[model samples]
Structures are given as C-alpha cells and as structure tokens.
Target: MKYSRLSIWNIVVKCCMSWVILLQACNNSNEAIEFVSESYGEAEIISIDPKKDIDEEYSMKASLIVSSIDYFPLTLPGDMVIGEVAKMIHHNGYVYIFDRHTESIFIFTGKGEFINAIQRKGGGPEEYRDIKDFEVDRSSGNVLIYSPRSQKILHFAITGEFLGAINNKVQHTSFFPISDYKIAIYNSRLSNGHVFERTFPIQPRFIIANEAEEIEKQDLETAYREQLLMYPNSSFGFYQVGDSLRLMESINSVVYGVDLEEGRVYQRFAFDFTSANPPRLYDMEADELSTFVEDYKNKKVGGWASLHRVNETADLLHATYFYDKQVCRIFYSKNNKSQVNIGASWMNDMDNIPMPLVETTTNEGELLGYYGSDMLSMIVKHGKSKPSQRILDLEKSQRDAESIILVKFRLKDF
Candidate 1:
C-alpha cells in the first residue's frame, strides 16, 4: 500500500510561528464533505455555540479514550537541551519535537528515552544554517528539516546522519516535504519583499510546487487576508485519519480532507460559529484592527476564529483553538453535529484527577500535551483528585530536571 508522495500543501511564509502535525492515511478521504448549496450553505455547517456547549459541561474520562498513558521526560545530555517545543509529532513509536529555542529537532522513544537528534546547525553546503521546521518522511522514516537560512530541506537518518538536501524556493519559511520531489507551502499573504516581488504569483493559502518552483496544484477558491504584517506560526496544517489526509485551516472554520496521491482536495468540513461572535476584520483599516484587538482583549468578541489542531475518532472530532485569546479544546460529535465542551484539559473524571495542561490532538488517535516538572510538582502537591500512581512516581524522578513531560495517550473510537 505504498503510495508516491504525489502532492504538496500549505506552503508559505514560516516565520515567528509554530506548527506540529503527524500526517497519516487510512483508506480514503472525506469527512462530512457535501455540497449543500453555493451561496447559501449553512445546512451542513456543524454549528458549535460555545456558550451553550460549555454550559452543558460534557466530560470525557481519560480511561474512556485511553487504555494506557506514557509520560516522556524529553531530555538532552550536558549543554544540549530541548529548548521550546515548537511542534511535536508522535509517529511510528517515536516522538519528534522541533525545538524552537535551539532550532533543532530532537528524537525520543515512545517510552521517555532519548534516541538521537537531527540537527546540523552550521554554514556548510551539507549543513543548515537555520531550521524553520521539520517533517518525517513517512515512506522512508527519514528526518527532513526545512531550513530557511540555507533554502534547503536537509535529509538525515534517524541516527542524526546527514543524507542530503533538497533545494527549495520557499523563502519566508513554513514549507514541508510531501515527497522526495514535491513540497507543500503555505503563502497566506505577502509576508516578505522577496515573495512580494520575485517568488510567486498571487495564489491561495495552500500551494504545491516541485523543486523547479513551478506550481503544481492549488485550490481556485481563496480567503481574505488579514493585513497584520505577521502570520500565525502555523498558517494551516495537514493531519491524517485512517487513510484520509485532513486539513484544519488556521484562520477559518472550514476543514478539508485531501487525497494527495490524486492531487485533489475533498471539502471535508465547514462549521458555522455565528453563535460565538467570531471576528470580522477582513479589509479592516489599521484603526479597525486596533479596535478589534482591544475589544477581543477586553472579551468583547467571541474566541472562535482560529482552528488550530484537530484529531478525530469515528464518533468524535476534537480540536484546539484560540479561545478568548487563550487555548481551549472543543469536541464535536459527528452524530450530534454540535460541540461538546470538555473543560480546559480532559476532565479526567475516570481517573478522578485534574490534568493541569492544555493538549493538542492528532488524527492518529493520540492526545499530546506537555508540562514542565515545576507544574507536575505543583499538581502532586495541591491537586484535588488522586493522579495515577504512575504520575506520582514520574514527579519524583523528574523533580529537578530542565526538560518537559510529554503526555501521550491513545484515543478510542468513541
């Protein structure tokens, strides 16, 4: 069932932002993709009125979705350290973390053991001066690090051995390897002078291009751009469920499923959050932008604009988003067609303990969340419910470490 990396997606300016996605495939694409109507299409919209959903107080138990959990104490030896985790992906029994502070990718085992790192921070022809992001070659298990500093995607073995590099025209950052030949770029707006003047034609948010920098596939439909002179660290991300590669847009409510081997986008989702006072700042003036920012900061607008990360089971679609200028998780039942608000983190009622961390989702049926040892110490000291014996022992072992504790749990088909 090996498929060629036939398409690229979500390529553009990758600067001062963050994105972590582990793309997987099942059998096919399409998650609630239906053409209701052109101009009037609220029929298929999965309306999530946060105020109503949050009040219902739906809770999901840790034991319900997960049969087990593993806490990985991510670490490095001596002066080496995993700085800030810009993006984390758990795939194939390995956890790959892109460290933003050090601009390196650190690899670890599934059970909290250090393996190796994929970093060559230097100014050589085979070296990358800077790494904007990294991705794992699903078909080959190779580590591909995208370096804007040297304009190449350096390939390396899982053992940190340099294999080679691919030349890319993606200048602003945020590009990923779709295959050995194609790359995905997310060029939302003109972020820099080079892209504005020389690189690409005016295109949509997602574009697939070959090494020659020729556009291969792009959606004809477009979105209005915000003129903030800055882009969200993750403009858009691609996630995989079963055999489907799904997309969760960073700025809007629509989600898509893509068949990369065929180079077509399956419009998988469209959510109507009008009940949540979503922002409307398209073509807004500077003064208008300032007003919107201040109002949002003062809690005047609903916090349902950006769709960050999403994971899905057969019964539920889970995601995280910018909620009132903070991160919060939202669960939508496919059958119910409405949002199910499960506290800041999973309520963990089944475990009868509070997980004091915000988590992200993956279509791979995994929940990824992280907390430093300091917070773990606090949770053990003054938490309401009793944590599992495993957590308490972890807190004892990592009492004075400079690394993060990654919470990895498998999800069930709710």
Candidate 2:
C-alpha cells in the first residue's frame, strides 16, 4: 500500500532527526574518549632545542655581587649553602633571600646586616621541609612563605614568628606568593603514572592533572612528557595580581586567558615555533601526523608564555614558539592598561643594563618595572662560575642595577 505524501514526509523527517541525534551523540562520545585518552596516554614533542648548556657569561653577570652601602652580609645557616640569591623580597627594610640548594631562608636588614634564619627542616607549625618561594605582604607587613614540596603556605610575623598556615586545597608542583593572601600555583602531569603536585591556596582552587594518551610516535611522546615533567601545566598556571586573579591555559603551545571572575577561558596568544622546521617523529598515525603538519603549516610550533606575578601584577612571559632561543617577551598590566616589553639576556645578557633595565608597552599599552626572573635558577645553577655564593652581594648589586625602571613621560600636543 502507498502512503500519503504527508505521511512519507513525516517518516523522512523522523529518520533525519534520528540521524542528527546519533551524530551528536557520537561527537560527544569522541570528545569524552579523547579527553580520557588525553589522561591515559601522552603527546609527543616533534622538535626541541637540546642545548642545555647554561651560558657562563650570562650566569656570571646575573650573579654579580656588590658591597652593600647599608646593611651587609645576611647570615644563613652554616648547613645551608649560601648560593647565589634566587629571589630578593624587601619588606620592612629587610631583604629575604631564598636559597634553592640549601633549602634555607635568610633574612637581612636593609642596611645589609644579617638578621635571624626564618625556618629549619621540620613538619611542625613553625618549620618547612622546603620553602619554594616567599613574598612580603607590603600592606600587612607579613612574610608569606610558599613550600610547594610540602604543599603548605606559612604566614610569618616580621620578626620570624610563624603566625599560621593558609588553609585551602591546591595541587601545584610549584608556586609563587603574590601577597599576604594570594599565591600562584603550577601543576604538571606525565604519562608514567607519576604526578608532580603542589598546592598554594588561600582561595578555593584545584589543580587537576590527567595522563596523556599514547601516541604512535613514542619519541614525540617522550619529548612532550620530558618537557612536561620539567615544567608542566604551562597553560593552567594561576597568578594573582593585586586583587585580580588570573589563570592561564595553553593549547598546543598557544596561550589563553582564564576568566576566573567569569568562569570562562579563551586563547589569547599562540607560539608556532615548530611550524617551519618540524621535529622528527617516526610512524605517526595519519591523524596524529596531520597535527604536526598543520602546526608546521601554521608556524605555531614553539609559541608559548607562562604567567607569573611581579610586584602585584601578572606578567605573561613567552618564548618564540618552537624556537630554541633564550628570549622572553613580557606582557604586564598596570593602571588599567597592559604593556608588552622584551626582557633580554635576563640570565645571560644582563650586564650594562641599568635600573628599569627592560621596559615595554603591553597589549593595553602601559609601562612599569620591578625586575623579575627565575632567580631560582641562579641558585640551582650556582658554582658554575667562580663568584662566591653570596646572595646578599648579588642582591645588592642587582637592586642598584637591572631592577625594573620607570621612564617619565607626558602627553604632548600635536
């Protein structure tokens, strides 16, 4: 029997609707699978710069020590190696030097006289296994110490009394405190079923890591895993600038902004370093290989930036995507304006540059300075040069030179 045209049309429409539903379900399932795979396996690094050599000249200049005109010779525990200063936090006229190797915290008066050591190795309320970083709450006159390995944040009175610990849950492997109540945390994940986690929270925040999916190219996966192990969660880093909190995410080495206030995120920067000269990977699946080819076509291999808070502002520093160059472009936001500038030779080519050494106009276009770096590297790579591991000396010399600068200006009439 022949059906009515209307009836036939209705049947056709129902079939089409069913197909649409099936397609949508499949798409969602694939997404879920991909996400689960992302957690189970790992991605590969098609290319990288194997140059691990620390430039000696750069290290020397970066670690240069000078006589303190005021207080001098901050005393550290004899057991702790007074490695080159990794970071200098000046508050209440005292300089706190965090030594990486010695895992010690040394305090000195602004006049350069040694004060008392802040902490020793203990799990009690007053002690720390390792102090990853420290910052002064200028407004509160409180010292905040972040111990990533211990997963704790300790608040200390200016006189070295432990006031209390910041109570919150976090999963960052590394962290930097931005203020008395704020800190940035870094979390990373690798495929060997090993997770590197550290927590720095005065707020309700969580760091989640998922194992990556297994790719056909083991070498690429190895490289990606290795880099991730060295510094993972580049995209998911959290930074606190004053009262504003910033979360940065990375997708394929491109940087994205996390709208914590809005609970939304989007890509803002891309690093395509590996696009031109793709790295070698053997026997990648067609779909997997296509990603690299597309990256090469887009010239987006090495483009990436990480977030760090400098003097109460979030600075996004990035390297040329996919390129092995030792350069970082910094993006700073201030006075409701954003400025971008290049911090050259921060580690290697830091000499001859005076105070306010590096400056730039950011995406929103503003200028400000307070010299910042992976000072931890200075301690981690100490003794490569012949300079005495005097953190106070290094800090004194740098405080006078190379610190962020401010240039005076006025709007001119055309």
Candidate 3:
C-alpha cells in the first residue's frame, strides 16, 4: 500500500507559519471574539512539579474516596469472551461496552448480567462494516453508531433492533448528540478535494450541525492537521460534564469548556507548568522546533500529554504526562489552588498493590474507573500472604469470572 511520505517536521513548520498569519488577520478584523478565551472566572492555577520522590508538600489526602468496588461477572451465553473494551458508557442502569477487537457493542445490566449484543458486522442494510464511534441518546434510548466505511450513522434501539440510518455528508471522526434535532461533530483531519482544499486553510476543528444545516463552527488555535499527523492517537481529548462539553488539546495546557446548547467556549482551565511549559507550535523557530522534536524523541525534555479524567464537583483534574521515560500523574485542585505530583510509588501504593482506582474510564459527574480482569488475576495469585477480607472476597468471586471490575470514586469534601 502506498502512503504519503510527507515529512512531519516540514508539515508542522508550514502549518505553524500559516496559523500565525491567520491569527494576525483575525485579530485585525475584530473577529477574534470567536476564537479568544472567554472568562467564566479565573481558575486557581495549580502547578505540579516533577520530582524523583513523592514530595510531602505536594502530597495531600487522596482526592478520591473509593465508595464501592463492584465486579460484573459477565454471563455471556456462549463462548463469547469480552475482549478488550475500547470504550465504555454507563447510562440508565446499563453498561455499554464497545469492543473494538470484535467490532461489536455488548450491553449488560448495571449488576453485570449480559443483556444482548447490538447488530452484527455486515454489509447489508442497517448493518455496519465498521463502527468508528458511538453515542447513546438518553432521551430517545437510541444508540447511534458511526461507520466511516459506509459514511452513515446507524441508529438502533437498546434492545438491538435496527431503526434507520442517517447519511453523513461530512466525514466526522466522532459526534456527540446535543439535542433531538442537533449534534456536534468533530473532524480532526482535513478532507481532500477542491472545496476542502480551499477551506482547509481556515477550517474549524468542530462543527454544530442540525438535521438540515450546520449552525456554527469553531477553529482551534493550534495547528490541528500537524498535531493530528504527529500524534495520531493522542491528539484531542473530549469530555462531557452535565450541559458543558470540555475540549483539550493534548499538547496544550488549557482545557476549554464549551456550552453544549450554544457550542461556544465559555470557560477555560489552565495548568501552571512553570519552567516546563510545552513548546507552542506557533512560538518556536525552525531550528528550535527541530531540537524540541529531537529531544522528545530522545526522551530528554517534554512528553505527550493525556487528560485521563476530570471531576467538576470536586473541581479536580487528573492527567498523565511522560517525561524521561517515567509517567507521572498531575492531581490538580481548582478550588484549593494546590497540585500534587504522584510518582510510580504512589500510583502502585504499599507492597505494589495497585491503587483501587488509578485510571479512569469515564467521567459523568464523579470519575468512573475500572480494574481489568487480568490485573485482578495477578493480584489474586501473588498479592499478599494475608490479604484483607475485601481482597479475599474479590479474588474468590472473580476466580471463575471473566469480567472486569468497576470502582467508583468521588472527591473528598474537605
């Protein structure tokens, strides 16, 4: 298969230069309001410093208090094993697990009883060749699956009944339903052709489309195409909290909160990296950018950024960044103006017993995380000589189970 051998370094430099010129034009035209950051209120900046040891000053009480750990013994009828769950959605007393390996969506009750698998993969009518993404409509109880190969959105009921399909004119990577009549679509890569070629220079990263028309669009400050090409897997992060949709660029420190109803940036959360502020694409010269990229490749300076979870009620944000071959978590508290740098020791905790919930899967109101079945099996076999009653019970129950365990946590009210 032939691939585009375009040098990423050259593309980044060109995109950055183009972005600077576009910003200047927008600033002069009095149209910067559409792109400029609006204030909800200044967020208390929390700076997490890198350290070899867990600094006592930064270490405070664990932000999340584990409420309960539940295990769902998946009771699939046949030889179907729950493959690696790529995405999970806990909605309306049911857990929706999207398994990418099998290209199937499996539904289970809140208590872990197998309900049914959604329509199978096929090329027939109402069937999908591939499911790029999916969203559950709580109001209508419909599961909307986006198939890139077919370029259509397949709608189905919770019970696996096919409803219909919506023709997707715009090849969006993912979508979120804002209302019954509207959706917010995200496109990370620029399409090829004359229309897209002409508009590619100023195309927005996201679009708000109704049943009939596109109502609004917003462009990002960073070079979207360059970043998408550089870090294909970890380019953008999207989280929905209540009525607000949060968007964050993996290479940037700011998290923008957009109003779901209006589809505009309403608030922003900035992280104080202090001396370690990442090199902005628009600010670095060619030589400087080359050195920066080289350093990153050699594991010398900056690392890729991933926002793992965000808790609105606790005013807390959890993220991980890799530097010098070590992955560290940034625990930031928005209300108290404090930050913690948790190293591997803290992440692994005492006796190398994995913390109850160190990674998050979804964040609706509180953070929802899980322990994989493989991790549980290892803990059961080699954890401790005298395990706690909870650990013992968890191990015993999961001895014959092939399901992942779930852990829910909420911010501790100080």
Candidate 4:
C-alpha cells in the first residue's frame, strides 16, 4: 500500500510534533541538558562584538588569493544588453546569468563568450510571465525557471530548447532545486483569507516537492511565528553541500541539514548568538509583540541573519547579517576556531580596489563573485588606481559595453 502525498505529510507532521514535545520535555530535564552538551561538544559558539567605533578597521588574514578576473562579453547578436544580474551560476563550462531587468536568462561560455538567451518572456505556452528565481539541473543539463505569477516551473535545455513545465500549486516566494526532479520552495509572505488578518503565523514556510507532485512540508510554527511577525520579508537561506541540502532561517541562529532523499531534516547546528539575539514574538503579549515588530522594522530592537554560506570543505562559514541598522559580513572558521568581522573595508591588494561580492560557489569549490555592469562602468570612468589589463582590453574591444565582471577565489586556510 502506498500513501498519498497529503497523508504522508500528515504522518510526518505528527511524528515531528511528537519529537518536538519530547525535545521540549528534554529541555526541561537536567539529563537532557547534559546530553545536549555532550552531543554538541564539537559545535562552535560565535559571539558578535562590534567595536565602539563603526569605522574601526580589523586586519583580515589574506588567505584567499584572486586567481583571475574576466569580463563577460557584452556585444551579442541584436545588441542585447545584460541588465542587472539577479542570480549567477557557473556549471559545466557555461556561465548562466539571470537578468532581473530583462527577465531573461543569458548563457555564456566560461571565458565570457555569449552563447544564447533562453526562451523569450510571454504568457503563452512554454513562456514565463515572471521569473521569480531559477536553478540549473546539472545532471540533466536543464534550466528550471520559477514563475510565481503563472505558478509553474518552466524547464528549458541549456541549448535553448523548451521543455514542458510542472504546475505548482503553492505560492512560493523563492525555490531551490535539490535534484533534477526535486526542489525546495519557500513562502515567507503567507495570507489567510485576508491580507492583514495575521494568519500567516501558522502557515508552513518550507515545502519539498518533486516535478510531478508535492512530497513533504515542515513548519516551525512556534519558532517562526514571532519571526514572521517581526520581519515579514524574512526568508530562509538554502545552502548546498555535496549531496546534502542545508536550510537556515533568515532571522534564526540554527542551521538545519535537510535529507532530500528521506524528505526530512537529518541534523541541526545551532549557532550561539551571545548578545545579538532577536526578541521572540511568542514571549510577548499582543500589544508588546506589535511594538516589538514595529521597532524591529525600524531597526531598533533586533538584528537579522540575511544570508549564510558554508565553504566546500565545511571549515569556513560566511554570512551576512544586519545589526544596529548596519549590514555586516562575517567569517567563522571551525578549523581555527576563530571569527572575523569583515566590516565595510572589503578590498584586495590593489588600493581602492573593492573585492567583488561573492554570489555563489562553483562546482570546483571556488567562490564566484560578480561586478555588475554599472560598477564596471564606474570603475572605468573614475577608478583612482590603475585598472587591470584584462579590464582595459575588454573596454577597448567593445565600445559602450555593459558586461559583468567575474572574480573567482577560495578561502585561504590559515
């Protein structure tokens, strides 16, 4: 006998609730505390201690070295301009960049040669009205585009062939593909009957589904209800480590390892945020929760963990967070058991040469960073120091070019 998706999900939820109750009971027991301490002996606690002065500079160990800087060719046929990049992925010797402004995916060679754009945008069949997010299925060499408006996952081959789409019922804000047939969808802004009825607190935020149907869902209702109220736009961070998928809530300190094959959470690592912990909504009354939510929106009460990514070796963890109305980048290394606050001054050896923002990790275990076309134009116009020969040559080759700058680097081991 086979169970339906809904039935399976219900069973899973009941089992999870039982586990939650058991965990809660254990939390109240001394034996549970001892067990937790022993179990998490390898876990590292990171404390955020901001300097008295915001402008205080801390020396970062130059472990990662820039290997090469290359520019994507801007001049394609029909004079297409690669607008602001929404997301970038390097796979199989091809660079896939999704331009938010144009709402199109552009394909390029690893050396930045323009190949072709995916399908054109439309409301017709095999076309997407809006692309909320996208991911490449490397195993099948297919590009999957999520269209929230159409509620579909449009599929296309890397060679620009249009495959059929999977009909999606859930209204997801973002999605990450776990396999060629499976994906994890997240919805932060949930409505119940009305827009401001305050029913979103109980809705499930994460769901796992396959191409043909939904699989299972997880909702940390007690832990996320307050977080959703405080930060309506907060979402989960999805990180891929080999075959395992890790999910981290934007405002929470815990990172959960998701078992894609089993459709359940396998393990969890809770980061210790000593002083910068956000206020919980469950602990506050209605009026107090409202006040705290307002303060949090105004950047007064709580900080948020916006993005998190771990290196391929699993030794270094890089995360971006907001605290005291300032955005901060942090590097925590498990190998060295050290944490470094990478403040506003993120530059390379070249004076005034800012390091490109790391967008994602490549298959080869190198961090891929991008310099937008606008930034490249500004650098060419008003850069104080000498530009790289590659940049100068690219500028000379294509007059009025609007190409993206690519930088690849790996975290230096201390």
Whole-model lDDT values for every prediction: 0.58, 0.36, 0.54, 0.56
- Per-prediction TM-score to the true structure, in the order listed: 0.75, 0.42, 0.74, 0.74
> Considering lDDT, which of the candidate structures 3 and 4 is the better prediction for this target?
4
User: By lDDT, highest first, what's the ranking?
Assistant: 1, 4, 3, 2
Query: Which scores better on lDDT, 2 or 4?
Result: 4
RMSD after CA superposition, every candidate: 10.0, 21.5, 10.3, 12.3
Model 2: per-residue Cα lDDT at residue 140: 69
Candidate 4 versus truth, CA RMSD in Å, comes to 12.3
| Candidate 1 stretches greater than 4 Å from native | 1-44, 53-68, 75-79, 171-173, 191-201, 220-235, 277-305, 313-315, 333-339, 350-353, 356-364, 412-414
Tens-place lDDT digits, model 1, residues 350-377: 4444543333444456666676665566
Q: Which has the better lDDT: candidate 2, or candidate 3?
A: 3
Error at 310, model 2, angstroms: 7.7
The alpha-carbon deviation from the true structure for residue 7 of candidate 1, after best TM-score superposition, in angstroms, is 37
- Across residues 1-414, which tens digit of lDDT does each residue of candidate 2 receive? 121111222222221111111110111011111111111122212122222233334333432321111112233333433433345555545556665545556666544456765655678767777766666665665667777556567888767788877642344434444444444444333332222122111112223221121111111122222222322222234433434443443334423344433433344443332222222222234465566445433444433222222222233332321113223233323232333333323332123222221222222212222222223123324424333344335554544221111121111111
Q: How accurate is candidate 4 locally (lDDT)?
A: 0.56
Candidate order (TM-score): 1, 4, 3, 2
RMSD of 3: 10.3
TM-score, model 4 to reference: 0.74
- Using alpha carbons, what is the TM-score of model 1? 0.75
Alpha-carbon runs more than 4 Å astray in model 4: 1-44, 52-75, 178-181, 192-201, 210-235, 266-273, 281-287, 297-315, 350-352, 387-399
Model 3 misplaced regions, further than 4 Å: 1-44, 52-72, 169-173, 189-197, 212-215, 221-228, 232-235, 282-315, 345-352, 356-365, 384-386
